[model samples]
Target: MLKTAAAAATGSALSSLGLRAASASTPRRGGTLRIGLGHGNSTDSYDPATFIGGFMQAFSFARYNCLTEIAADGSLAPELAESWEPSSDAKQWVFNLRKSVEFHNGKTMDAQDVIASINHHRGPESTSAMKPVVDQIAEIRSDGPNRVILTLEHGNADFAYTLSDYHMVIAPAHEETIDWQSGVGTGGYVVDSFDPGIRAALSRHENYWKENAAYFDNVEMLTIADANARISALLSGQLDVIDRIPFATASRVKSLANVKLVEVTGSQHYSFAMNTQFAPFDDNDVRLALKYAIDREKLVQNVLSGHGRVANDHPIGPAYRYEATQLEQRVYDPDRARSLLKKAGHDSLTVELSAADAAFSGAVDAATLFREAAASAGITINVKREPNDGYWSDVWMKKPFSAVFWRGRPTEDWMFSTVYIGKSPWNDTFWENESFARVVNEARTELDEGRRRSLYAEAQALVRDEGGAIIPMFANYLSATNLNVEHPERLAASDDLDGMRLAERWWFKS
Candidate 1:
């Protein structure tokens, strides 16, 4: 019920980015849409919390429905939950579930299902990456069959937006537990065959509640981690749509008569995370030296092909409401890096940087560029080209230094709580600052806009100067699709492929 006007303005923003304006036309259905993705892993799982790459994020939204959804225009909208109302303090939220919604397995979705599904990510035993978000819920209870109420431990102004996370898909409830392994949910499509890290096939759910949506008869998703392979599939007519278009090949793809390039500015960012818990990286001076050593400008021009803006060493971007734009932009300075290394009591520093294109297109090249730049500052960086197949499991977070990408959250608090918090399961850097913790926690409950922005500014400063994350650039969500596969004008900038809901929101033109 608290929809923002930002949705109405998203069309103009996308139009400026060269996305063809959508005309008013009837959508024709009944075609198999083949999608090529640049992300997936062999270690992926049925559990939503374990989802690491864009492939699983898109697949989850295609086959399962969250209580709430971030709409194509970047506004929060209802999905399984017909509507929601928040308490005056923004602590308690009550959601009214839609009636007669059936799961893929013919189970009727109700309040109990919502409760059980949410509980799957809560509790001390839960190892879900979203555990930090759900841990704020003090209690969850059903008012009736369709109404579910959640009371938070404290007032959180952005509590409702948290429910739209891809990991919050509701499943069929059975005796206080939900079955997630079966892939049964009240979504637009039902999974037919799933091969982790490779491909997935699904058919449209005939009983889907949302009418006039999900026009595709079937959807086949292919995991092509290599950037070249993904573009080849698109040009060869082997795929109808593709996500994560490589910036280097973007101009060439745009020139193809059969292709339509889609780009939207969002919170997506690329970073090099150094494990602060490990040696060498543990020293703040060493971390600052690394941060100053990399040339963000070169990465944006060379690696991103001038498609993104340089990022300060924090996750908050221009898209977020409370981005600390006033903070001094950190530029590459070899002398500063050397001074920081000396302050850390190191004459020279050497470290291996693990990278792969699976992290993002041109990630390995970015690592090589970073190595060359760091050499000027008495830092020796060894670029390790890791295999793309199991990079999420074997390299990311597991390795001391690695390339990573994030399809950032809609809200600042959600992003920080997920990856920057001390106890966050997906805190790849494993770094925490006391000042950051205090400001972020306080800002979560601060309802005043001016006061909240000030608190968040302090929080961003803390993360920029003290955290182990080296955020180099914020990239736009660039995708490519054949002209035959039609979509809405205002695409969601939240995640790639229309906020990872392309399978549900898009349709064939013929």
Candidate 2:
């Protein structure tokens, strides 16, 4: 729906990124897989709360395991927790942990460890993003050695899916506090070294519980925020895997037979977020004007180089459950945009929109394109290029209007609760739809599939037409990998690089 360019252009663009074809190769173990990632900061911490991009997730998978994980095909699969079930009302849940899973520190995973890890984000001093998630839990206690029970304030049919969140990684517990600096977990690999924004090293855990994964003997995850640098690393035989490949340069990367680009369509959405509390943007009509002024199709075709699909002003892409598919896509209309601006008591409105490539692959270019399109609608948008180093902390939500990207949550309720909820710290737009809040709560507890679907459909409509984020495109996860790196046919679209499990599932084709 990107309202973007022609399909041929998209195909031509993707040909370079490796989505044009698939390969059949067998997995062989015992090789070091060097990975180059496109996002991270020197301030990055070992705490799961500090995770900012796919780079962190990839690194965490090297030493930690969540209760569940998102599979290559987007299904939730058990990890540390062997089995789980919910109460009749779905307000209470119990997880049976796998026994004898040992950490690198010689500690066995137990119910107490799980309880302590959950409490880390629940403590009063905790400022974790997962705080809101665990805040819903009234109690987390152990019934026995391998049994853990979680009592919720309300029913959540998808509560199990919540455990799949990367922030919920289970770490060793000591005196009600989690000892994460040790970086020990029952994962496929053990952390040999970690330097946040620079590079990380991990070696395969000989005692890893999962018998089928962690094929590589070692892995090195490098944070290269520059696209040029990431590409150069892959082309020059420096990295075996790299993600966030630029859409415009897909062809250049694809032409290399030793490497292939991987594209998986999912819930990733790119937007120019407006501070709904600010002027001009605070007015719904003005927001609508800005929305109508941007050409989504051209953005997908020209700016995204057809590597994405047009979004309908909402973060929930078509891959999301209960998406409002029947809703008419918002189209480009400069005259209508001008009319809306005039109605908002502004014949012409001038605003500064800060952006950087780190916001998305080509955000500066997209903002420039938007500026050209809005000029016809009597709107002057000054595209301010902000530095990528502090864009996340400085310009993203701090500015009145700026660019942001949402990888999206596994569930609709999770997505809304994480970003759109009025109290969420990541509520970049400061949008609070009263009806949507009520509907999301209902959908979370509604066990009736039909009723839940209806509730989500209503919620999606409100976000698409009235939300504060101007979602221009739902992009496919694009990454370039070497010919020797072998993974599953269906890869993870929810999280980059096979759900950041490349170290676990991939192998060298020797």
Candidate 3:
């Protein structure tokens, strides 16, 4: 007998949990901050030119300063640069650097430092995630000691916003080495010591330009790979702050008196990506059928404990303007799914579902939920869970079929280029659509907001209709902090950790 829809959706094999609530009191100052980082993926690099993930982002926060910083409201604000103005044609951007700003190594910040940093990312063999943004620049030259000029290939209204990217942070030009251990930046703090993938210690920079910044005298960031271990550390008072708390444990943590949970609706989506160039998923009907078979709401509630939001047909969230609201929501229907599979000449379909143990907050439990849901729809899903070591290189980026965790990007163009674009470095799905490509390229070049929005809307529609990616839910970026520390009222919207956690501003009240 086929499993009933309600029974299939509500199947439970795991215990439930909750998030810790915030205490009612003001913050005090002066204490050594110990933060538990979720995990340190090998993707962590100090080159700024090629860094990815929260580890690098967290490290960069104290190591470098950008010309312009993105405000909490998404506006571009001056950081290292005092101010900036665009030329009449909108092609050239002239920035006035802050003269009093000095690097941690006692070197004064100048336009030459900005030029060198930008050029380093633009050069070959660079690993900077901001490379794409700098690729549009025709030239970056120092106009004077305190002035820098940027000539873009075309007029881009978002050029200033691009400068606000964490990876675009300026570095010292005279540094003999790129070790990053020397702590030669103009940021709020300076790196005291760094033991890769283990621990990183930082101290407040005495010469920080921003007033009352770097409130904590010392910060020790520990890389804790296991969710339970991190949670234990937080609850036991071993950690002052912890990030990426598991959904299952959120409620339990919230119940505690000392912990304060901060839930920011992330731009990220956790989904199973099928290779369109490969066998079974090559057919659109098979892909759609698979998507229809999985009970996503159940996974969100049961596995993720309803801490996440459901993705509207596409991965891009409501925070972006181009999301398609008209597309039909992909609900689970085992009957329809089975019918499609049988029509495609497979009465019983078997597929491999690969996942990484430490990829998501509750990934192991989430995969089991998927297994049960697929089984109810007459599909045999063989689960393969890999360890944290080399999982990205061996299972995710290299494998043809896999379940991957993706942190949501800020812009629609960034999401398209990174994941769906043909031959992209991180394009694991390997979907190649000529029309989709055309739409994205056009959207990138279109300066008019209305025209670009329309183009992106069309592209999102195409991805939902033709793409093989099954976006289950939009995961929430969870951070738990001690009530004794003063955090920013608003956090960065992007899941990228660099700007999201204002560690520099956090002060421990006594």
Candidate 4:
């Protein structure tokens, strides 16, 4: 017999154990899927340009469809566009939209909708995080009702994969403008009702293009920012599934026969970001001193409860094809940390770092742990607890230093382009390195694997040594669900919770 799914991760071997229930079951449809997520704010919107949190992305995936999407095994699959072709140079590309695809508003989806939805993030007025990812698009023209041609500023083999981005939601276009506020698209569900961060409901789209999808008649997304509360909801049968269960309380799932804990390791990592433009952090020595102070091993063992692996400060994880693992790991050294702090001319440094559990499971506790460890190096971190309601808008990027988590991108260049590129909207650190930026642009088109690896290795070194981030551990995407919530084997590892597309792919057992 073929090996099936197994529960309880035995170290790193638990890669997408939830996707395989060990025993296969045919999908049964027609029930509301109540999902509880760890974070969401009143700031959530239907506008694709403003979707920052995974909760919003989760809801978006239910109500909207992308041109392309990452399949169960992390390969590209057609969603709206049935097929695509690229020029020999890999710069100019064309997509042929799937026929008979109808929007929730009963409008025909054409190449114009794709062009307008994409341009919403490209223009100068757009402050979206996805701005940098699409900045390379020099132009987009419609060849006809069914075809759209995209011309890039440079050659990129990953151009098609980039279309699978959650931000690339295709909306119904009326003239040159698309009504993003309506939440109408060609997804598997239709927006039944929405209240920003509170809760939203979606009904199955009867005309959904994919027959296997829309299995659940209705789906509901709830914002349960507290970790314990999210797990409690699942245990109480109030929720069918919950994402990002606190690592410490993960064992609670094992005792419940109907509730199962799932773990998938990929590029998901929790990090603390510092504004490089801010005082003290502006000094490279100060950044290095802080990076040296964190005990990554203890973080995985103590804070994460052995649910994750130590990270090397770069966003790249072991899952990515070009992820660099040859570099020496950064170890915890208080004496070395103090030496660097003194070198930076700060004998006893005091700083404020805002934190909340909403940023990630155990984030507040993680900061408290860091505070205790950093005190040994004569560094003072004032951990200010922020409210979950407005943490994303008020505290996150606005604060000089804060704790946050990143579900790493599918590709190295995409990760660098989003957060490390100069003048990019999502450059949380406000860090701009000339050499790293140059390498990011060149490596996108570099077909040679050896040459690409060398470039990425150098970039990783720069981030590890000079960048304003403290990456302690790359986390396993730990979740818990009632047995009634069924999913397929070999789920997408592009990001946590099946790239936040669980609403469409997962169905009720009944």
Candidate 5:
């Protein structure tokens, strides 16, 4: 069910933003729905191999069809490929492609295309998430026109689920060069136009195999960096849907009769990430002191307005199989924090807290909060804010010392492998522990669910004990949409715009 906050502050916030709450009963269709994207990074490549940005996920969901799709309940199900089965050893999986499926470019999807897509991501030039898993592929052979076989070096239980990832979407075999001009894939919609980092216009593919899919004739996604502007656009009817609704405005947006606020508890964990390779943070006591100084509860209640969940050290949520139950009770303790600082030979330590303006829900304010909290623990913090432009590419990823904003994955292995694995390209922290690495490796191959869960719990405990990451809060994704749009309940933490947006099911209420 949808929850609404009835406070006057929410109403005032909406009024200030020039938005009226949309009525719950209103419904309309056939009109082009404009969406305000809160943040937009580079996603110029149509090739799945090079696509990694959030904007790419939105675009891929609409235009590319993966072999499998994650269902509403987070279970893997067949999509472009009808069904698949793994060999007893789990080293090989065979997929039977759906014959009825065809690309928006009017070409029938074949086993060759699937094999080509997989190979493309496996090539030396690729930067796909499937790089790690695909590197183990010993061979990829097509059985016939519809069946494809994937032989890996070793067993991978999560192999099936990885096929459903947005990055693995199959593309035509003949696409020799990256072409954004003619972004083609076997999906429900065709790209009308793509203006990198600005807007992408998509038109429904009438030949879509899915019945009664993509209700909107056209979808105009506009990247709007300002929260106030996004709210204004939604209220003024310029946008039918909006993403990354400001927490300060969530209450106000919920009260508007003509607007519906959808909140999804996200896998994103906001943290003051320290480059463990450098400085005072390199010391365990210093890291522990910083973690104990900040109050996560206060951040959630006051800053986030109870929209998000409190996080301990691990980014993976409680629902994940490997979450450590014992660490759930870790809380703020300033006295302990001060003592830790003294133990680290720093009665008063000075450090720079770097954060990008574009990071976090209330990033600037969040940094301010951290500064204040550090002060209480007798630690000196110098807050540094960077511009949103090129922050991810030029600053966030390459920074030797900076705050980190990570959107977590559903599985513990995926989270650890991508971000914390010592040699991982995505390991921004540059912090590596041999014991943590060993646990991650064991968890990856552990076929038994219970055993794997235990491994992950131990891995998480190692992170907490060493203070690998300073997580303040688990972020909740909030969005405001016109009540005229139906199926607002489908949104999830994955930021699956096409799947969660439910654009196809929405209709006009006469």
Candidate 6:
């Protein structure tokens, strides 16, 4: 049956699960919340269409608000939209807006703003990463100044969760377009200054609608791309918290008197994405050869410091509802890799693998470890260490094979649609299977839970055997914060720093 929009998470329920470590003191307001992030590019922009990496995701949540939110306990919560109801078919949805919500510039928000903001990601000329998501909408119209309606091409039980994506931030309407360049929105903080990929400063919104939130008076976000520098900034008292803590040094940081380690296991995973359109990778045998060549257990132990688990050559992980736990775990087999490489018309293969630590905490080291393991299978991997400054823009999808990481989506359909679909902009591997694509679309609208599970399991099998992505390990979100900082009992596992809403969701103890 189709899932209802009912929220299953509550304060008492989260406390019972012990999701968050409780603090002795209550949350107090009025202090600067400083943060250092490991992911940021010099090419980062204010356009929501281009927001990628950890730094930009966190920045979006601070200065912009989406229509819906995935709460700390993994439940849907209303943001700008107060309430919503579907038209029984789950295709047409009507969202009632919150009354008198003001933008950062003091303009009252209405249905027109929501409509224009959503439509910006649509249309044929768009290059937004979320175009595939919004393209599912058949039509979007306003019922009145306070209500907006969206009619999807197919019935989707997880449509509300899609809008909670960081790319769907609402902005004031300007004719047919939104003023995304100004960084203006109806969020808890107002953008004071922004230098692309360098630093950003924001002040608390004076007339913020959520009176109980946004405890910080100011937020200073730094793009500390180096992992060591990011940790140093937090430990030296130059920053309050940091994301992407190096797992190799986590224990040492935890031993510090003033620092605390925060780790949450989620759907985040690391992959070696090979462009299927590129040479050698186009063969299915070649892809299978690479998949069997890596030792996932070593990666989990050495690279991750045993903070994660081995992953099949698919994106779905343990955090998702329909995770294929029954699927056989792929193990390292040099003889099988050699047989597959020979079947692909190659006695020995040589490939260049681009990698940088910006992709994850120990990505460069992970690639080196993979190179050592693949050598036994007659695979010579040239690990090219790319620069962190513009790695995502230059090396990620542009290179034939490169290191990558995905903060996996909340739902099965959402994950497959965003990255696995044929026409998706973020389909990093550029691998497409007509049958796999068809199964995913069918699973989206299937109302029967048993039937949907069967379809998703099939989809996982197809990707595991034929996909161009070599997913090896699912890493936990490891971060550190000062003891003076206080947050809710549970942090959002969807992404680091409480789904990148740390500036608003966290506070100072004093």
Per-candidate TM-score against the hidden true structure: 0.96, 0.94, 0.87, 0.94, 0.89, 0.96
Where is the poorest 10-residue window by lDDT in model 4? 1-10
Report the C-alpha lDDT of model 2 over 58-82, residue by residue, as the tens digit: 8777788988876655556679988
Cα-based lDDT at residue 39, candidate 3: 69
How accurate locally, in lDDT, is each candidate? 0.87, 0.83, 0.71, 0.82, 0.71, 0.87
lDDT of 6 by residue, 368-481 (tens): 999999999999999999987778888989999999999998788889888889889999999889999899988887767689889999999999999989999999889999
Best candidate, TM-score: 6
Q: Which pairs, if any, clash in model 1?
A: none
Comparison by TM-score, 1 against 4, better one: 1
Residues 397-463, candidate 5, lDDT per residue (tens digit)? 5665566677666466767777777766677777789999888777766666678778888888887
Give per-residue CA lDDT, model 4, range 343-422, as digits (tens): 99989899888998778878888888888889999998889998876777888789999988888776788888888887
The parts of candidate 1 lying over 4 Å away from their true place are 1-24
Angstrom error of the Cα, residue 9, model 3: value is 39
What's the lDDT of the predicted structure labeled candidate 5? 0.71
Residues 111-203 of candidate 1: C-alpha lDDT, one tens digit per residue: 999999999999999998889999999999999999999999998878878888889999898776889889898889999999988899999
Off by over 4 Å in 3: 1-29, 87-91, 174-183, 338-348, 496-498
RMSD of 1: 2.1
